[model samples]
Target chain A: MIVSGSGLVEALRAGRFVVTAELGPPRGADTDVVRKKGRALRGWVDAVNITDNQGGFVRLSSLAGSLVLLDEGVDPVMQLTARDRNRIALQSDLVSAAALGVRNVLLLSGDHPSYGDHPDAKPVFDLDSTQMVWTARNLRDHGQLLSGRSLDPPPDLHIGAVENPFAPPVGFRARRLAKKVRAGAEYVQTQLVFDVGAFAGWMAEVRDLGLHERAHIIAGIGPIVSPQALEHMRTKVPGVHVPDAVATRLLRAGTEGFTEEALRVCAESIHRIRAIEGVSGIHLMAFGREHLIPEIVDRSGLDRSRFDMNACGSRERSADAG
Target chain B: MPPPRAVPTRPALSSRTLYRLHRLLEPNGLYRFVARVVERHAWLRRPFTRTEESVKRKVFGCRMCGQCALPVTGYACPMTCPKQLRNGPCGGVLPDGGCEVYPGERCVWLIAVERAEAGGHAGDLERLHRPIDQRQWGESSWINYWQGRDDGLWTEPGGRATPVDLGLPVLVTGKGDRER
Candidate 1:
């Protein structure tokens, strides 16, 4: 079943470890890749997040990809970015997504224009991630605009925000997460996590500040594909750290066996994360390795029987079935 | 990629005017008068220059340059400036002037409108619809300015500290270093 924000929260309270995966749409107008990825992860995850622009590079609209996922019987967490839209567009998309029964959303401030293919294109940060969370909360809970104008019917959305545990001034992430929670974020999914200790410390701070009670915190884990990919993540992706031991193992595995190593690493990571008391769930960013998620889940020993498999067979299944 | 550009300097604001305004508002009587005037008329608060017709025309023809507010509004420009959409709105402006983005807060534009009206230029309201030139300044600089003002450092004696002084070495690094 498509989990509502409250449902996700309830699941966390019930000690269920929510699992989420990402689906990156193709760069062109094709929906095949997105649909395939969505279909592949159908019953393996709680929700499949359609990335707006993974790594800030240009790609198909996340909304479109999310729609495809919805069509494929996967609950989609449509990633909304303020980088290219104003409040009006943002609201319109939210309402549209809700109307289409795509309830989960990941609000993002998005990467700056400079990071994308179109550096000269103007960015529209009408609302930062925090403000977007507030907007989502207001729209969903109050059924009103900022001006208090009532919506014909308010949207019912599961709002989530991103947290980068590896961000510098690392101490500030917890506080930032606290602010997001204060702003009405129902859940927070972190950026790719390689160091469980760092993530644990960050969660400790969140607990200390009482934010844990307000939002479901999901640790993000991206499966490492190769030594080169691992090195790229460590050096290229700022704030993402791959531990020396993990990096060494992946390197020693070499190119051909990297996929196996990746699955093992990810499975272990999931296991470690699932053992954490305060951690509510795990967001798997398999990066183009969508096909391996089911294997990773199986190897990790997570209980997938709880997810609805019958719904995965057809697109017409009720979203609430799961 | 080209080397990162040097950080630009910020425009100067009159401390005398700010102090005078601060002092004037400190007295309950004067503050009430200003507040009363601002409360009655929306246009009086945020002054704009264009008429509805002109604004509409520009909106249809907007190139999205976002220049209208950058030079004048100090980086506090609205995301909805018809023509120039630099950044998103504060996410606080509610449909009714209360900010949904910032709970229990008045919209920034409403505050600006009130200030303009209180300052005696109600006609400026029409100008609020003008197209803005968003690219007039870099996003980082605009954000830096925004942050400085938010922290109350922008109005402090000497100009607010640069990203460099604030230990943002990345801001001073090569091309891609400070882009984001």
Candidate 2:
């Protein structure tokens, strides 16, 4: 039986570290992908984020995918990147997403059109992610639009953001995250935490500034269980700082047993990440290998007490049983 | 690739022309002199102000946030960018120096890099700069420059201060940070 599970906000507010998964919308109008993925992640993830034209390429709209997940009895966080829309469209979509039962929103400065399938498409970053975050909070807390016009009933959204612990001028990342917290981000998922030591240093500053109390810091992880995945992320993904030592570990895992080693490596990172004081939870990207998450989560044993999986009334519905 | 759109070159004498008239006027005391001359007479200042708006709107996508940084930005207005980004290019900048929004034309950041290179002031441009103060919106930035209402640098309208006394904490700008 399907039932409305629990809100991520409740989990975080109650001091339960939360887990969220990202689902990239299909390139075409195939609702099957959304349905299949949504059902798979139903109970296991606290929330599922429907990516909006991620990488600045055209895809099935995030709104459509979000609705699909919502129907599957799994809550969704609509990821809105400010690459193709101006403030007006952004505000409109925010309202629409909330109206459609989306309780969470993740703001992003999307990839350039050149990075996606349609390099010829015009990009619009009318409000960068910071401004977008501020604007979203304004709509939620201030009950107004970018033009300062009032909304009769504002949309309710729990805002989240992304951070890269190793971006250049590393000293200011904590400050930047602080600014985002002040702007309206209630939670932050760092760019994949490949280097646990580096991430711990970044976390030290976050704790120093007392931002962890204000924003739930979720560490990002994905099983790059292959030598090819390691090479691709290190070379292709921007702002992802994969140290040579981590890459070499994966390469030495051997091709036949690489998947197991990769899963172990991810689990090890999770094991190490859970030891960090300020971290609230973990975000598993798990692009093509969603099936590995259950075992990985069980193996890591970080925040394994989210909800019960048997009953929906007194007990929590199964996160994977949908 | 789409054919590049014609970006507006600054007028020969406007505040945005020479490295945005920021550094040039800053060191030479030209900013104070020009500001005083405008404040000297509303009659004289009004017409000159009208011309700056009309001309700048065409040549530079001037949002007139009261802070000018042409000298720092290679004289290409950050306001023209679809994102209106202040610190630097959002990760979306095309490899060809074309804008992510208008791929047919060069991004303002590309132009800023070229100008900064030409002026040899790239190192100095990364200093802690403030976000725009909305009070000066739609006003003449050249006048604001003289009045001292720069990005988050002023306390109120028509305010000026010593750089050492900005009071606001420093925040570094990132190259790939999309929220600049």
Candidate 3:
């Protein structure tokens, strides 16, 4: 059933298990990179997330990418990071994104610049991610900016935030989500879940706190692609926890059969994560391997017939009718 | 008792003692007297600020944001975080509780959560801490706390269901207010 506004929000609201995927805009001005990825993800996922300078590297803006995705009939969850922009720029971009018919937004603190390509760049974390979440919520719900200036037409947004359940202070991770929910995060996407057991442990705490009922908790998953990528994420990526057993399994698959084994691992994770209560959906992060998502989703045993691509496009014309 | 020294060489008081001391100084009258004395006695202010800074710097690696979050954060200083996050751990924290930016160092929030849970102040992590008061940087947080300068630092009332007031100008609800 096609909704008048954000299909991702509508799907989650309707209690349909949602699926979202990431799309990193290319470093150059080329629109084709975003479009090609968007086209590939259109029917398979409910919404595509356009990253905001992902990894702190300079790239085509997530705002521009979201616009391109809109042209491709895919709903875009435009990510807005607090790492680069202060309150003014952040709010300005948010208003502009809404006026241009961008519906979903994911607020993040972003990777510190040191982690990105430009290690020398001065980091601008004027507002932490939680504050950004609260700021966006106020703009959408109260029709006011952080400065208390009234917005004639406040940006209508489905506010979201990111969390890493496998990170340290795992016990406090769920409470952090609770704070975001209190700050008006309607949905949350987690850090990559290579360790399903640990992710489930965090979800159990989330359920204990009844946070799942308050906010849509979407588990993050990704196609490992290669043992090299697996090792990179295991050792290098912050917040990602890959159990040694999974590493052993993937490494044992060897180079020739690695692709098949990696996809199988991701698909199995999705299957296991689906059974965990409070998992409203999954956010697929198949970075640079967008083509693998459809097969991974199919392998996860999700009822693909229920994923109606026609109903999932951004419906801008009828968006404000509500 | 100090929760296994975050930096082994650093010396400090136990978090429980600090928490108790913090609670003791929270009453307005006690801190207000100190604030007034520090304000009136210019000669003494420098020594007072210096002593507080040097002591806290050694104990907590405090960056002296002039609004200490130590009590709420289980004595772990959020200002020391590479990103200086006051709310909670960011998504980039390493799996082993390492800082995302400084891979070798432990993420402060992880230590904070563990210490907070151990110290029986786990509920404070859920509070929506306000952004740093930039004007207070380098000043003594004790004086700021005593003068009630940091009283409004929380976006919402702690442990309450009050409506959020970020200290912004009040929202103009009516059409008449909008016209003005």
Candidate 4:
């Protein structure tokens, strides 16, 4: 009765809204921070996502971080990026993740190396995000490689992809999302959304294109902490625009109440997103403020009953009793 | 000569034809196809090239056009053309026999060495060489060709499959052969 990839899919189909949280590991090789984060959020969130050198900054490998989470009895969503590894290394890590019972995965065409701390580092885009999702799904279903050789047993993985609606050429983003769906993306977690109306418009398009039927679309929500951080996000991060009103509110609130104001905005945004017809869930990227996830979820008025211990325990009991 | 076996007419170009032509103009299709197919089917895609190489040889080697232009001149094109070594070898092969420009496999120059020796033209192997007329075909024309091929128009005479003679010496003008 363990929640497999298929189980997640089934849950989505059954109108059960899924929630996932990000776990940002420390810069060095230490696992204690990741292990602690994983342990804290265990059984609370649907899946604990291990980020891959987030923001193109250096960090422990997502593979290693996910492995630690897996050992800690938490379901891990291994984030695969085309930034660091070629197809060989990417596939190798994916197989390893599957073997270790990490069923869910997020395929990302990570930020360019120029955006990272190591600007000189080479970016290996052997396969983009859409291709990565297709690759994962293919490995899970057909047990084969691109060369058409057969795997002994195909890995079972829940393939997910990232979507950014705020990106320029908005139409291009929509088309790319559709392409990702065609490429076997079973779920899409979008870039952190500040404009609920824009997010809703995107969801409507997803419904129009029949993407909701093919994949579970999850809106990304990042809680703002300070005016400086908000300013940095708007100016620095391409494709991420925090509306002037939200920025004004944060600015007016001053440093004392910035965190509270940010949480409220995130909570309201999540509530609005959840109300959208095609939205299946929310991905809370609290940046380094991982502790704020539960608060955001609570304030968003989301029913955690599906992930509640009693419900999970009963489902297990029923399966066992049957 | 009773109509000389009706030279299998080249298909009229279309979008698909253009893409196929684009693919054909490249060194190898199987590797490209394999790369694409593997992207779509990761479980079946393997890193090792022995099986892939055999597949390429069987399916696309001589059946495809660009392979003939490969420096090896015997085996199928390795499809490992490098950006830096636009001409021939800069004599920078690594100790591992891989190209300094492209790290994984044998240098194109090194492969050409064996090929030149086999072909009894070892002397020609030492001279720096460039690729033969590598022009990107027109997209609209390619699509028309593809459509023609798909619709069986390529087999019919005067249906745009006329063999426009491409005069030879196939020079490697850095500007590419627009004249041809």
Chain A TM-score relative to the true structure, per candidate = 0.90, 0.93, 0.94, 0.92
lDDT of 2: 0.68
Please give, for residues B39-85, the per-residue lDDT of candidate 2 as tens digits. Answer: 67988778877777777666666655546666456577766666566
- Candidate ranking (TM-score, best to worst): 3, 2, 1, 4
* Model 3 chain A worst lDDT window (10 residues): A313-322
Poorest stretch of ten by lDDT in candidate 3 chain B: B1-10
lDDT per residue for candidate 4 within A148-243, as digits (tens), equals 455667777788988877653343356457656755688888888888887777777778878888788888889889877887787566456678
Q: Evaluate all candidate structures by whole-model CA lDDT and list the values in order.
A: 0.59, 0.68, 0.79, 0.59
Ten residues in sequence with the least summed lDDT for candidate 2 chain A? A313-322
Better of 1 and 2 by TM-score: 2
C-alpha TM-scores of all predictions: 0.64, 0.72, 0.89, 0.63
Clashes of 4: 24
DockQ values, each candidate: 0.03, 0.11, 0.41, 0.02
Better structure of 3 and 4 per lDDT: 3
Candidate 1 residues B51-130, lDDT tens each?
Answer: 32234223322222222233222322343332122222222133334433232544434443444445553333222121
lDDT-sorted candidate list, best first? 3, 2, 4, 1
Best prediction by DockQ: 3
In the range A194-287, model 1's lDDT, one tens digit per residue, is 8888778887888897777777888898888877677777655544667788888888888999889888888888787776667778888877
Model 2: colliding residue pairs: A43-A319, A44-A319, A123-B101, B19-B70, B19-B71, B20-B70, B20-B71
State fnat for each of the candidate structures: 0.00, 0.07, 0.62, 0.00
Let me know the DockQ for model 1. Answer: 0.03
